[model samples]
Target chain A: SQELEQSPQSLIVQEGKNLTINCTSSKTLYGLYWYKQKYGEGLIFLMMLQKGGEEKSHEKITAKLDEKKQQSSLHITASQPSHAGIYLCGADWTGATNKLIFGTGTLLAVQP
Target chain B: GAGVSQSPSNKVTEKGKDVELRCDPISGHTALYWYRQSLGQGLEFLIYFQGNSAPDKSGLPSDRFSAERTGGSVSTLTIQRTQQEDSAVYLCASRPDSNEKLFFGSGTQLSVL
Candidate 1:
């Protein structure tokens, strides 16, 4: 079974500060996805990285897949209150079913 | 639908009772998925439905859990003899195909007492 581990299970940052969240997989990553979710709401898609060494950005957030394709990172610059949420990283481990295996998630809190 | 829609945003049922959750995926979507999220926990994959082929129920936690998709559109997830541990938010997601990203529904919060 494949597992995903996220570092800094919870984070608290002051507005305008920058922070990074890491997601590492036990197996090679075929496809990596980043999603943000409110406390009890559905997830909002952030970005997807398939190829190793791929990087994508949206607004102040940027996601990168390491060259080895086993780890990925999400970076937020000038964090705001709206940035506070649970960040999850999902991997497409099974190519056939396309079911995603998600990490425990990193809870981010941006203090004003 | 514009996106995946789940009914009964919240449900409260007695233990040992059965509950059914519904999900209406986006039109033309070929794949639908069910996931569970407990308090302060990550999402757990429950089942996967792709096209007319047999669904992948490998992720189902137990025989008490079952789901079905009709006409490759709407899907229903039923939990029999629900227990207290069954309390969680059941999320439904759908994608156009295997290679596309998924769109999630608001989810149904179930509380088994």
Candidate 2:
């Protein structure tokens, strides 16, 4: 089964600092989605990138896909305490059903 | 409902009991999916339903797990004779026709003791 490797597995940063989380895959991704999950809560959709080298931003967060569509990075600028959560990246590569294979996830802790 | 809705936000059952989790996708959406999330783990694909096509159940962990979509709108996931390791967050998501965005439900937290 295809899987995504997200690193660093966990990160802690100052509230005003910038942080970047990376998700890498061996196979080409048809679609990549970024989501945030709070403890004991559902995942919140953040962004989706399909086209190679595509970049999308929402608020202070930005997501970019590599030219090969096999790697993606999420960048958060001037993070706040509210930015602390488990970040997960899901991808579709099989071209099968709408099922997505997710990464192990990055746990971000922003200290105020 | 404005977004995906799941019933029984939390479930606690005995190890040998059967459990059912329900999900109602967004209105008019054609694609529905179920995934399991263990603590500190990624989402595990379970099943998918698209239109009237046969559902894809390739991700189910075992025969103890089964899901069904009725009338193209709602879905139910059943776990029979659950084990202690069956505890996890069951998440449901729905995507509209020709779209990549998947709206997710709040998920049901299942714990088998």
Clashing pairs in 1: none
TM-score of each: 0.96, 0.95
Residue B75: error of model 1 in Å? 0.7
DockQ comparisons of all candidates to the true complex: 0.68, 0.66
Residue A40 in candidate 2, Cα distance off native in Å: 2.4
Q: Which candidate wins on lDDT?
A: 1
Candidate 1, residue A56: the lDDT equals: 99
lDDT tens per residue, model 2, A1-112: 3478999899999999999999999888889999999887778999999999999999999999999999999999999999999999988885645567788899999988
Tens-place lDDT per residue, model 1, A68-90, is 99999999999999999999998
lDDT of 1 by residue, B1-113 (tens): 67889999999999999999999999999999999999988888899999998999988999999999999999999999999999999999998888678899999999999
TM-score of chain A of each: 0.94, 0.95
